[model samples]
Target: MQGYILQIQKIKDEDCIVYILTNSSLVKSYRFYGARHSKITQGYKLDFELEHSMTFLPRLVNTMHLGHRWLINRDKLFLWQQFIRLFYEHLKELNDVEEIYFNVLEECALKLDKQNAKRLFIEAYAKILDAEGRLHNCDFCFLCDYEIGDKVALARGFLPSHEHCMNQNGFDKDEIEEFFKTKKSLNLSDETVNRLYNILLDGF
Candidate 1:
């Protein structure tokens, strides 16, 4: 199916919960604004139906209601839809948090020869992972083979994920390709970059 623009807000808390906020009025009015006989009551009913029936809508709601701090924004819904399609459907990529945390540290470490940068990277990973565990309230971590606890960072849209699962999935590859393609090229450690490269070699 063709993707449509959607106005979306992606909220992230220290505790890894991502919330999506949107202006529902615009969503409902998009198609029926010029429909014959469209009235106030009909608009309400249509809004109710569209919000309720769409599978992705509920996920956004749950994120907002549950998370302590929510990320909020108003943007074109088409861009949101495009992001979802690219990350979830086409490449099965991971989220922004993971990319930033790992990429930034890796870049700092290699280009500047900074061990502290690597330390910060690992630290950030732990912090975010802890937040993910706490928010989801599950100890079982997918990235770590052992059920270290009850939390597994279920791959949500626009969030970071554990390093291992990021590799097992295609997120790492997308990160590398996208990173190199960007003008501000990344400085990834040889081992870390090679690991990602090997995964890409294996393919999905």
Candidate 2:
């Protein structure tokens, strides 16, 4: 999907950032200035030039939508919450989960060990869950003939029930690469990665 370009500048107060967004022919603005010694209850309006772009998905985004109404509706927060829960459950099963995962991702310019493989796979899963307009996770397993401890392999980033399930619910290779690049950009450290992984695994 083509991402919205955010142009940011410091506000006159020097505490907040004024962000201007441009997409296609649309221009929009928002202001974010953190309060001193406390949190801010901010207000925002997404002023896009075209009202429809504010609601409609582009072609690539539609593909990622995965035909899930839970994702299609903005008020259905459970869809995201459930996916986050599942992600943590899977992470708990890995031995060197965090250290092997985030540390290797932070150092993606270099090659990694076999331990890094599963972490890398899970990271991709987490990111597809994080994308702005899609519910990529839970789609396959929820309706498939697979169990939690099942060893699944991914084709084009889709974690199908098995290799046989690849053609029916697989993602494209480009989708996998996109998730990898996006997760690596987060630059999460080994410790923080482990902490989050453990928290999720522990069902927090």
Candidate 3:
């Protein structure tokens, strides 16, 4: 199967535990390091085979790195690694995850070099929430269960609350509402994108 290496944990003697995000699931595989084996880096896409082992995790072998033009750009690559790391945290505990998670990463990766990383990150995260049926209508304040005012403080998953309720500055009601509906960060300022990105880091 083809997958993106989300994270690699080094074990004894350079062996490692690799967490991969594939089309249908998050899979963990073990790699036995050897001089003949190519090093695997996080964020690299690979076409690989899994060798089932009786005493260990599935063995990763015969790997071929899928070439993406963005890989050569260090700045873009760093952003990709940082943004993709969030998926490991968000999905690590889940047993059943929708295929949209992988699709979101694939779509975002294809556009990373063409668009602002913060904007792409926000949009991709919103897509994840939408697919999970957690992206709610941001009309009422989740805290008070009342209709919100001109400002809304969005929690980790864009759960809207009145600014007074959250005791923090809120986003403009109309703008945030549009963002929720469209899942597009193009209309939002970079500052707003950064805020949403930080909230995304909190979790899925």
Candidate 4:
């Protein structure tokens, strides 16, 4: 199956725990280190086989790295690392992560670049929230439950609130509403995009 390497934990000499995000689930597979073993690292999209065992962790076998051209650029590589780290952190508690989640990561990996990484990251995150039914879908403040006027501050998980109530600066409520509806942030400024991304960093 095709998957992205989310994390790698070194164990004893040459052995490690590999946490990979497959299309439908998050899997922890054991890697027996050897020169002939497949080269793998975080943020790598790989095609590999897993040998399941009742007595131990699944074995990662016959791995082939895929679509690694993006890593040739250090800037894009850094962005990809940050993106995958977010996934690794957010999905740690879950056994079966959704396919949509994997797709979001894949989409970002396929489209991310030095110039548009931030925008694409924000867009992908917005799509993820929408897929999980967590995207805020109200015209009122999530905190005070009051109708929001022109300006609305967004909290972690994109929870909306009146600017005064949240004590945070934010974008126009109507534009944010449009962003929610269309899943596009093209018109948003770099500063606004950074604010939105910061909210995501506060967690899923």
Candidate 1 yields a Cα-based lDDT of 0.29
Question: Residue 134 CA error for candidate 1 (Å)?
Answer: 9.1
TM-score of 3: 0.93
Model 3 residue 199 lDDT?
85
Q: Per-residue CA lDDT of candidate 1, range 151-170, in tens? A: 12234322334445554343
RMSD of each: 16.5, 19.2, 1.5, 1.8
Any idea what lDDT model 3 has? Answer: 0.85
For each candidate, what TM-score against the reference? 0.19, 0.21, 0.93, 0.92
Per-candidate clashes come to 15, 1, 0, 0
Candidate 3 C-alpha lDDT tens digits along 1-204: 998888899998899999889988888999999999998899888899999989989999998898788889988888788877888888887656678888888898788767887788888888888888888876798888999878889888878888888888898888987988898887898888888878877777
Candidate 2 Cα outliers beyond 4 Å, as residue runs: 1-74, 91-124, 127-169, 184-204
Q: Candidate 3: which pairs clash? A: none
Model 4: per-residue Cα lDDT at residue 17: 93
Quantify how close model 2 is to the true structure by its C-alpha RMSD in Å: 19.2
**Pairs in clash, predicted candidate 2:** 16-33
lDDT of 4 by residue, 62-109 (tens): 999987566888887887788788889989777897889888887777
Prediction 1 TM-score vs. true = 0.19
RMSD of 3: 1.5
Candidate 4: regions farther than 4 A off:
113-115
Q: Name the best candidate (by TM-score).
A: 3
